[model samples]
Target: MTIRAYRDADLGAVIDLWRACDLIRPWNPPAHDIAFCRSSGHGELFVAEAEGRIVGTVMAGHDGHRGWIYYVGVDPARRRDGLGTALMAHAESWLARQGVLKVQLLIRETNTAVAAFYERLGYAVEPRLVMAKRLDRGDGQKNA
Candidate 1:
């Protein structure tokens, strides 16, 4: 398999793969994936291609001081083949080159399996509550 930066043409396949794996919440609109790919100075998307097909994906980003990884997925048939690890290694290398001081990610609290996956990859949970409030116009009004 070959790992490479994402191309605009790969968007359809990437969205399909995420849906197939039930990776993102059902309420999340498909357009969000496109936005993530196009977001400026925030993140980069990558794909793992094998036999002319995209089989895995990852999104890596830096916030000046630290790097954040999100939306990592591998096709079900392609799991346990080291693609995830390879993709992460690529992200880590890129973040290091950019002088990011730390790397972090959040997994659903119910995803014990994935928590173990990250642990094996040398990631440990930070003992702090992660909170967020949407700032979109409709929600911003509620906060105000």
Candidate 2:
């Protein structure tokens, strides 16, 4: 597979891949997330393609402090073929070029398989709580 930056036309295939990988949640709508990343200009979305198909994707960027990765997904049938690792490597390279010092990503507490995969990539568990407040609810209203 070849790793490359995301394009507008890749939306359908990317969302389908994320769904197949069980990466979508009701609270985090895929289309909104995609638009945010595309416009944020802080991070990049990388997709892996093989046989003219999008097989994997990763969103990575830094905020001038540290780098973060999100929405990492690989096609179920395409797993175990090093596609995820390749995508990550591409992300890291992209971040490093931007002078990012540290890279971090979040894995659901119950996602043991995903945690293991990250561990294999030399990412360790950090003892920190991730707190967040949703600023935009897709309704042009802030949460009260």
Model 1: what TM-score?
A: 0.88
TM-score of each: 0.88, 0.90
Task: Give lDDT per model, in order.
Answer: 0.80, 0.88
Overlapping backbone residue pairs in candidate 2 total 0
Per-residue CA lDDT of model 1 for 1-144, tens digit only, reads 998988878878988898876776754565675576457666788889999899988888887778988778999998888888999998888788878889999777576688877887999988987766666556454321
Q: Which stretches of candidate 1 lie over 4 Å from their true place?
A: 140-144
Q: Every model's Cα RMSD, please?
A: 2.8, 3.0
Candidate 1 residue-pair clash tally: 0
Off by over 4 Å in 2: 137-144
Q: Candidate 2 residues 1-144, lDDT tens each?
A: 688899999999999999998898887888888888779888899999999999999999888899999988999987898988999999999999989989998877667777888899999999997876676565555322
In the predicted model 1, the residue pairs found to clash are none
